[model samples]
Target: MSNSEITTHDPTSISRKSKKKKWSKPKKIWVSVLVVFLLFLGGAGTYAGFLYSKFDQTLNKISGSNGKTANAAFIPVATEPITILLMGIDARGDGETLNSDVIMPFTLNPITKSATLVSVPRDMEITFDGHSRKSNYVFPHYYIVDKEHAFPKTKEFWSNKLGIPIDYMVTVDFQGFREAIDVLGGIDVNVKMDMCYQDSTDGTNINLKAGQQHLDGAATLDYVRYRKSNCGTKESTDYDRNLRQQEVLDQLFSKLKSFDMVTKVTDILNVVGDNLETDISPDNLKQLILSYMNIDRGKINFIGLNGEWVSPFMVIPDEEWENAKRALKIERMRTAANPNPTIDPKTRLGTDMKSNYRSSGNNASSDSNSSKSQSSNKNTDASSKSKEKSSTGSGSKATPTPRSTNNLKSNSKSNSNQGSSGVEADDRVPKVD
Candidate 1:
């Protein structure tokens, strides 16, 4: 066998290949164009007639497996709800390592016809046993240790740390991300402020004008990758950059929903055939599209965990942690709870995307922060173990409120979008306007 074919499951193989192979500018362009085509598949499509045969044959070339070194189950269709970790990774200059540039969990709510993304910023500090780097590096570190098992381990780390159960993880690198956008003819979004920066070492040059504009693949990268800003009026931080990434992705999906995407289906398949990897198969992809295709963009919710800055790692407060568990539905043996739940031995803090907070004690509704106790973390007991080995808290009712980056105020619950009294949480998503 050739040297190239020797190690199928070694993480070092990526490095070896990187050193041995380098695609020319034209080849890179081709790869990008093909990948952009591949991205069109993420959106739903009806496969009847000759179209069905064509896509099926192309998808056959795209590989599927656990996308991890360890064996994991293929999550089946469920009525309760499902969570998919959409990870955007970028190759380090050396190509030996890849960092998760964007980490967002897109949860599909069948009942509400909505999807909520609880994005974890790459810089969110969490202890990874002995070492603690940005949350994003976890993927690369694990991948290097064991290529096949890396993904499962990465999933487990976040699951354990955040107290949220993740059903599946879909990883796409920066190259694929850029190409995908370019192929889709780019995306239009409203940039909150002017951004200007340059990093020759990494080949990142971000110079975007503030306000609404169109961004191609490279500019999309610039827009999202931009964490620092020259604009004095704007807040330049990891959190804001993450918000931009989510906004761009949301806009991208909105644009891709058109019939025009159908033309790019074949090219999309081949491009992503290599660039994208997930435990989910092509069939699973199709099932997802069919299942959550009607998601209301307006009801799409975003929640960010509020953390107390600890020297190196951002320590989660107890109240926030409980609220997070309640928001994500990991507290009970609910459909979305971890299959084998283990109480996190390490003590920490939490809250989530919609800024939803479910207290272990209260079910009362408060329209404003004034009605709520300002005593600061009333039932939030840092010493007490979570309700169970799991973080279930059914007593906490959902109340819709404005999202907060700081304390993550207001649990938004919608009567119109009734969720599983037992499985799903509040879905009274605020209008995006």
Candidate 2:
């Protein structure tokens, strides 16, 4: 058989293709302790850094069976890799551009590292034109300054303000957030108390038991946002709720790892994709999968912004936020210190792909190299041909393209930012859940 014919022979190829097209298929697997997402104060300390490392490894193992391809892996065909900037907006009643509660930019370096999640506090006070305003309110200046390009505009403003880069954006409204969690059969969270609180803007009356329980949309809303009221009864502060949100994310991630979770993810994505806007395309996702396939779960990293809030300028104040801006810019770009000292890159899969890419690209085009390439091609062709023959005799499709190594990222967006605003030092929730 000719090289092309021989390469078409493997049944493994068909199986692989089937698997790829059905990448989102539901599985029977169930992993409950998803750790990456933790409430900023509670769960964040434990999961953020380590969980991402493990998740990367998991992806690598999954992609190993599919042999790596050189040209088609992750390098975008038409453009540079995309960086998705996701925001969780908290818009209250009758609010428009001025109300973005949660502002975090998730940067995916489509080449080697997995997606980077960077969280910015809503209370950050920024100086736009001449007046000062909450960081959440800075979206208006971003939108106004560059009306034609939402993602770039928002990213540029935040990146410049925070001294980082904001590439693409995906902003979700409140309704989308609620629906996503609910569709995932209500995430499992560990609440510390039978909390009760009322929010006048969203008209939320939240009450839940303290302990490990499954939380529906409504309960999660209350659990995540519940801060003690001013009378010193309820905990209130972005610091307090950060970890809670992370916990919800951890649970959701764990759930997404399951086969049933696959169905839910598809459902959620379909339901809210339009609500979520982003510069990352399906191609970007494919590349991420390729790189993520090699990262070891233990090598993933996370960095926390360590700063106190200070009052100086506006509704929120600029001093504390200014300090935070200075402290957090590097961490936002995933250049933060590797919290786990023992985390090794060689052990992870994503890092391997990056290393491989470097090594492969460094080669010269020579006669010896050409011969070796031919030999490798021959072996691959033989394997594929064998599979193809089996499949055809058994009444099946042709050989399939293997699933390449790629990183994975699960995202959600908030609608608006309207609730309380102010700054205080050590604002992070003090305990881990």
Candidate of highest lDDT: 1
Candidate 1 ranges beyond 4 A from true positions: 1-72, 78-80, 110-112, 229-235, 306-324, 330-433
TM-score of each: 0.62, 0.52
lDDT of each: 0.50, 0.41
Candidate with best TM-score: 1
Q: Among all windows of ten consecutive residues in candidate 1, which has the lowest summed lDDT?
A: 424-433
Error of 2 at 298 (Å): 4.2
lDDT of 1 at 160: 43
lDDT of 2: 0.41
Candidate 2: where are CA atoms >4 Å away? Answer: 1-83, 95-98, 110-112, 140-147, 228-232, 293-299, 309-433
